[model samples]
Target: MDVDTRHWIGGRRVANADTFEDVSPLDGEVIAVVSRGGTAEVDAAVAAAKDAFVGWSRTSPAERAELLRRVAAGIEARIEDLAQVETRDNGSLLRSHRRGVMPRVAMNIRFFADHLSSLVHSDFDTRGHRNHVTWDPAGVTAIVTPWNAPLMLATWRIGPALAAGNTVVAKPPEWAPLTASLFADIAHEAGLPAGVFNVVQGLGNEAGAPLVAHPDVRRICFTGSVPTSIKVGESAARNVTPVSFELGGKSPLLVFDDADLDLAVDLAVEQFDNSGQVCLAAVRMLVQDGIYDEFRARFLERAATLVQGDSRDEGVDLGPLVSKSHFERVDGFVKRAVAGGAEVILGGGPNDELNVATGGFYYRPTVFEGVDRTMEITCQEVFGPVLTLQGFSTEDDGIAMANDTDYGLAATIVTGSQERAERVASAVRAGTVWVNCFFVRDLSAPFGGSGRSGIGREGGTWSFDFYCDVKNSVFAPKGWN
Candidate 1:
């Protein structure tokens, strides 16, 4: 796997002496030696973006749209290689990358490209005068993406930022830095002008802090934990720079007694999608007391059947926990839960024998049966394949228990009654609430969180609103003055 793992600045791979190991969670192997950036690298990348912003911001929406289409094509052409390296880099299932992740990268770019072309501003006549409102491109945008589905999330922010005619400097997660280098290559090859999109690869403090705090950066977009987002917000505030964050969650999934049991059970299993490394997955499940016993029985049976091993395996459903430290963190949460009297119905921790056999950072798909809202496993955002269950006697109790958490990112509702579905969806304190299915995404819809989960919404017009400055110019009528 010989590849150019360096900072991408000014349409090329820039070199740096400070480097870090891109370790594989699959088997704890050093996949690549990547350049670790600092304040100097951040300054250089920001300067490059600042230089390109002047020209890029003045381009027509049609021009920006066409270039983005080319970027989407570049991703589609090399989707398989991109998917493979991503699986190798961060321990996500290869099947998911091929099926969803890489394809969505292309989709994210194409959707925003088309959106830019169709975008329309507003104009009105008021008091014998004409007022025209326009979406003006903000200058340089600083984007810091998380490791889980790194490329897809980056493009989710990147597509709109570029479509709105803003230049970008991104700090891809150091845990999975490979694909971002490849993404910058795709952007450059797609005829994106030099410095329009730059990459500074390093840790949160070394590179990420400097990029977000850079005085020249106009807007900041970040996706990761809530604690980190607070620091970002604080840094961005010093310059009064606007920031958009999509942070962590311990979102709830409400299952009513009237719900279809089979569908309910399957949805519970789907929480482990991407090995439960998903932020929106409902790890905290609150079930109506009527169906609690049956749902728990069926859920544990299905959870036990899930295969955990090599992410490259076609039959596997779960993989390693992304890193040794992350594995430890998730395991620590479970240990505390067990210590506090929460019964682990399935998967307390990793199987040491199997872990030694594969040399992979693996954890069993865990479910806690007796966890209350006070338990760490029930309230905290365990970004691993962990589930916590509690029973509620009535609809009010279920919704109340669901909203008890500090996070309000997303939620899932399961019920057979239409009235109940509508009422519960409205009552649930989350940004996005799913009534029946899970992970069904619409590109045009506003996507983000509430409370400690996130700061703003993005997707389609919402993205444009955040990435661009909406301005209005008023003029007197020809004879009015």
Candidate 2:
């Protein structure tokens, strides 16, 4: 927890006039103070990246793969420290962070290292003539990553963008910029060239906006809320720069009568894993009418038993919501749900275990019954440890309730029969559907949304296609020419 007001530009850290403090969501503690960058630092980062793009983009794919391999090694070596920092900064549970954060980030790095060269060198031939398609990096990329899953999300964008030969100006959330600073040092050890990858620290209006709006930036990859995605999309449009966004979700989880009650309950907690901050967290639970009461009983039993406390506490399964503002926002939604006639089935209070004088954004993992599809809690994205429960009498009704919301980022259908699982999974409108399991993701599987959830996809080996353009090269016989 150090306060250093500087940014990585042209391969090294540089100072800025203004500063911002990074506060720990666990205890509302000032963990670090990062310097805010203005037009000068953003321009410098862009210029440096443009300068580096020439050689970096021209480097062989094998060489790029080797660099990515080293970056993976550096991250592996410091996995413990990185996981702890992510938990502290994002208020994710320590155990979950360790399990979910490290392995995934390393896997992304390794996945790209192993497959990027092949993806880049892959060629296509059509009609007995040579027609080739190559993947090239977009020249200067502005990566605007969210505070949630800082390192991992950055790797998702930066890894592929860099692997394809783009130089980058990565801007992490201003609330947790220090981790990206740490990551930059890790990259330095990984042998990335000066300006090949840079981290600029500042707020969206100052640093993020300029970076996105910069004329030299050819592409953008962002992960955050929908409103911000719209802004980034607008900037990209004005500049004619292609952009990718991994945005918000009001995902659903369906439980059928045949599902194992124990398993369904466990997955219910997983839906709120990280206190339900994940973009694709299963915020809505749709249970078949036959088992609605039983499912509710089991869900409340498990949810009531969960331990919510400081990230530093042992056996703490859930931590605080990000900050006071986030806490207020989530709490406000819960209040609205209650006012709208949803019954609080379980857990509706603040945790008193942590420092109470200055409450860290802590709230009980809440569940609501009597939820109608039209209610705000059921229809909107309540990015908190809050789950709204709705009962459906038939299979079609279950699907109808699951797809009721405008957001369709992800959903889960639990059933003992494969036919039923597939049937419901097909009917549910979402980018990802978990069959009998919830929140389980494969790095090689496509991840995105179906509706207002998001615009672009991430994850999977072939995900680079969403971020790059494809062109066909044709050859004719010399005699014909």
TM-score of each: 0.98, 0.95
lDDT of 1 by residue, 1-481 (tens): 5568989998888989999999988888999999999999999999999999999999889999999999999999989989999999999999999989999999999999999865786678899788998889998999999998999999999999999999999999989989999999888899999999999999999999999999999999999998999999999999999999999898888999999999999999999987788999999888899999999899888888998889999999988988888899999998999999999888888867668987889999888888777777887898998888889999999999989988889999999999999999999899899998899888999999999999889988999999999988998878553
Model 2, span 1-481: residue lDDT tens: 4424478888888987688887888889888778888788899999999999999989988898899889988988888888888787888777766776877787777786677745644555667667777665668989999877788888887778887788889998876666688778888878999999988888899889888989999988888888888888888899899877777788878888898888888888887777878887887888888888888887887777787787766788788888787888988998888888889987765566554854588888888988787788877777888887888888888888788888888887778889998888888898888887766777677887767777767765556675456556877535472
Q: All candidates' lDDT scores? A: 0.92, 0.81
**Candidate 2, TM-score vs. the true structure?**
0.95
After superposing all C-alphas onto the true structure, candidate 1 shows an RMSD in angstroms of 1.1
Per-residue error for 288 in candidate 1, Å, reads 1.0
Residue 365, model 1: lDDT of 89
Model 1 reaches what TM-score against the true structure? Answer: 0.98
Residue pairs clashing, model 2:
5-35
Candidate 1, residue 443: how far the Cα is off, in Å: 1.0
